[model samples]
Target: MLRARLTLVLGIVLLAAGVAGFATAGRGLRTTSVHVGTVPVELVRPDGAAAGGAARPVVVVVHGYAGSGRLMRPFADTLARRGYLVALPDLAGHGANPQRLTEAALDRDLAAVVRYVRGLPDADPARLALVGHSMGAAAVVRAGAADRSIAATVAISIGDDAAAATRPGPRHLLAMYGAFEPSGIASTTEATGAERVVRVPLVEHIGVLFADRTHHETARWLDRALGHHPQRPVIAAKGRLVPGGLSLVGGLLILIGALLSGRTGAAPAPPDRDRPGLRVGAVLVAPIPGELAGVALAHALPNTVTGYLTGYFAGCGAALVAAALLLRRPDHPARPDHPARPDRPDRTARLARPSAAALARAGLLAAAAFAAVVLPVHAGLTDVAPHGPDWWVVALLALAVAALLAGAHALLGTPWSYAAVVALCLPMPVASLIGVAPGFLALISPLVLVLVGLHVAVCAAAGRPWWRTVLAGALTVAWPVAVVLPVLG
Candidate 1:
């Protein structure tokens, strides 16, 4: 019983970790933006001048992937304050525009913005400059290469591979990138025709564009490229990594996997006495009971299935503990050598032999049903819609079920029952492959199935009774679904 409880707990923990991982991945994807087209183009002028300018140098700011022109507002405002006319334009495939960002489309859109800026009465068509961040930087580089009218250029957190070898005209070119930006590594390696290169220390790819200091530094670089001598180099102190974002989540997963494996050893051995002889009836009925129960439960209490599953897992845990205690009793037989010591006589001889084996097989089938429900629920919680209850709960319940199943097996001392349970648990991965909503849920389904299977096998080996085994199997299958349904919904 104690073994079974422990297995259930471990299983739950694994499930929790998987969910957490899914959440982290989803959050990471959400933080980035995807926008396209000309939503709003703001033109700012120095000296607090109103719009409608021409013949003055203009700086055009373009935002990155999934980002909007709004992100470039601060940069535009700063340049405007510095006596330069700033034009912030939304690129293709982002911001107000529903289209995907394509090279041909972006070039056309950028050309239109340039025309708009040039038409401004206060702006100088001869002194046009272009700036971009990330994907935006790539677009700007491509634009600069094609349009020689651009007098100067600034690429922030620019991708190295995307950098253009052909410099636009003899005009000044300034390249600024953060040291920690993975994309910047490519920038440094790529041969940009720029006469000068400015590398900023300690700034990450994203940070170099977003951080205030980095922005100021970028501004200074622009000034230098424009023939203005700023007092200091435009660079800020290296920034630190954000602690509680995607990085933290990844670290947590590594830590949890390591801790769980170390604490929970391999599955316990099955007692030899409980080994069942070949029986056609037991084999045939192995999968039917659990499938029927799972289907019935899902249909009858569609809304409350998750809760029912949780309760079932809890009961399994209790059974495992009880089985462990019973097995440890002084009266329980230790081996076949002590057959005369009737206190723990082999019950297999009295009971119809195949019946016990049938029950163990049924338990395995139940675990399979539980896994099918739990996996989808787990995926739904983390991937389909993220909410809290955390992956820890799922892992705990799975481990508990595993422990109960193992304990029962130890008590039963039968091989056929244990084998049946293992087989039933094995199908989880196959079921998961068919489909899981919210996509990312599929990532951890395999792990959950494998762990649950191991738990059932251990319990069957421990010679646990048919009733206890069946209950544990049912809970193992059900608990995760119950816990995740509310959050997923």
Candidate 2:
């Protein structure tokens, strides 16, 4: 009854919080689905005017690689409150769009958004602007350079193709880079005579979008250039709440699961497995190299966040596998005449190889674990896998990794959950020491925390102290957040 009440209370609180946020952030904004030739785009328009009003200025806000434009509501609302129309379109392979992840495809889709927004009957084409971050910035440069009629372009935390973004044009440019943007690349610093370059302090790549300076500067530049003096900028706190709201909703669901189960969890066996080399190596030595390799490979991989994540997980996976292979001590068979009793726990017995059932369960549990954690992060915070097929890949990857853990008995604890947690817990310190950028880490941090809570709650409710359910859940989600997302961003 106590557990039931706690679960009910938490669930109600989270649900209330989410609804309040949805109401707050969604005040004047109306979301509509439009297509630029079968490529669906999500447009967030101000509720004020119809087709007959005085032509309003339009700003197309583009998201970074693998990002959903819907999540850019904070930036969109900033511009919308100032009497400008904002169109946020999901580039190919992101958001609700069904295309595969590719830069060339994104550029084409971005161009389509510009054309569509320009054609709006109540929009002033002369005041049309493009605001893009990271990959989106690159997209704007490409589109803006091709058309000189654009009034302004704001490029934030740009990529390598910035040179293409620099063709001398009549269009005004304001380029800003975060202080710790992992990709050292930036928009042209040598003023194009028409461009304004300013580096934002105390931020990294993802932070640029939400930074106060970014909001202020972007609005100020657009208002002046577009010839509109709107009201004093009222930075809405709800911008931060939208994603948090989604996470809260996910939490509510977990609480529901717990209440239904109505039992406490069984804890896993303590770490009794031998071979410190395997355990220590997986925990201590493997993460640094895996993370470093992931970051390095992110740049070299195809210019997609998905590709970078693949490289990141690949590195971490390889490191863990290598550690197991090197540290495992093979067991010798006993003589046939003196065969050991099957039921006895022999001190000299070989490390138990995981059965097919164990691997499958681990895979399924791990997938659920990752999905539980990532559901909110992707839906609210980051753009890891917002669409259908892309989300499936995340599940598949989690399953594969969990199965691998089952196979690596030398590294995994006898109960496995204890081993998984130990190995997983060691990465954060290394991540901090290497300076993975707080902006990037903050995106998934809440989701991770929520997963931890859910894991504990579910374990406690089910009357099982076994860590498999909890650890499997953690690994599924944490693999991408801790191992993949940070490296890519």
Candidate 3:
């Protein structure tokens, strides 16, 4: 009965964590610099000669905090190649300038860039545009508010606070971020814009800049805003469909797997017997001793033997725990005149009963994860080679992970659910530490945190101890913040 209860609690916790992790992963402000001011702007103009001709509309790209202008070079190049005069400027305290971030300092730098671009022979002072990331985006908004010459603005992963509220000059504004951003600040900011405001879905804070979906959408948006059609008209459609397909298939697989796991049932009953409690305890403890012995032997053995001893101790521990659980079961007593009531279904089994809501939530989570993995991989692969893993690979992988999770929940019942939640929550931090594909980590982080939070919330709803749920959420979300916040400044 205790084992069954434990299993139920574990499963609930795991489910909640998985949901939260998926939701909150890759959601944070990111900044980079583009050196386009008095100092030789790091921006790369693909059409250098074109930039020297008649005054063309100047598009100044600003990087986020702690980021170098080099980061914006690719974007500037893209714009420049399309006939716009593009400038990449490093923000104050980023690249070239080591000054700390301050409203005054940033304004001065922006003013300098504006003046420089206006003075350029090729730049048209009448059609100026500013695009920025994170803090840089905020800077652009501030500049636009004060400068009437600015024609359009693109702010990625930035919120409209008091400063943005006052801005009224830009004819068009584009604000974008991942769907699961904790603050939903970007979306809120977009509401205040007078002109067109676009919100791209499935893009996280950093992902807004680099994820192929977001990147292509951004390029198209810019082109339209600039009164030009995209050179490649079907790019956006192709990018959207690819990730969308992967997410749909992955979500379906997860739902099917959950339904197939017999999770939609009531708890099973515990057998009646005088289980040997101490014997069970010994069975659990025995593995520790065996593991200790193995570790000691590994230290004395050759390096090759030591390398191969990875699972030796773990196997021993599992065996001992299994023995303990087996010994604890009570022996059957003689049947009374009336047959004993059937053992009560365990709590986990009862909780496992599939619900429409649970399935929907799981499907959404699976889709997001599917998108997170697929978009970046797609971008990376597509950039390098035309013939690579197709939509099927992404769908299969996402489905496989979801299926594994569902199976783990079923096998471990409720008690192990907590562990599973922890495992699911671990991916973002693990991915962050291990490094995901280029320009992908930002998109992935927020989804991971959201999933972890969802998992914790689910566990709490399912009656797992409140403290455990809170603890898991805190540990999963706080780790990255603790590590990154200090460095961001």
- On the 0 to 100 scale, the lDDT of residue 201 in model 1 is 74
From the highest TM-score down, the ranking of the candidates is 2, 3, 1
Q: For candidate 3, give the lDDT.
A: 0.47
Segments in model 2 whose C-alpha atoms lie over 4 Å from true places: 1-8, 50-52, 101-103, 186-194, 237-246, 249-268, 282-372, 382-392, 404-467, 470-489
Give the poorly placed runs of model 3, Cα more than 4 Å off: 1-40, 51-53, 167-169, 224-489
| Comparison by lDDT, 1 against 3, better one | 1
TM-score of 3: 0.43
Count clashing residue pairs per candidate. Answer: 90, 18, 76
Q: Cα deviation in Å at residue 330, candidate 1?
A: 28
TM-score of candidate 2 to 2 decimals: 0.71
Which candidate would rank higher by lDDT, 1 or 2? 2
For residues 202-260, write the lDDT of model 1, one tens digit per residue.
66554565566656766776676665433333221111122112232332233333333
How much is 149 displaced in model 3, in angstroms?
1.0
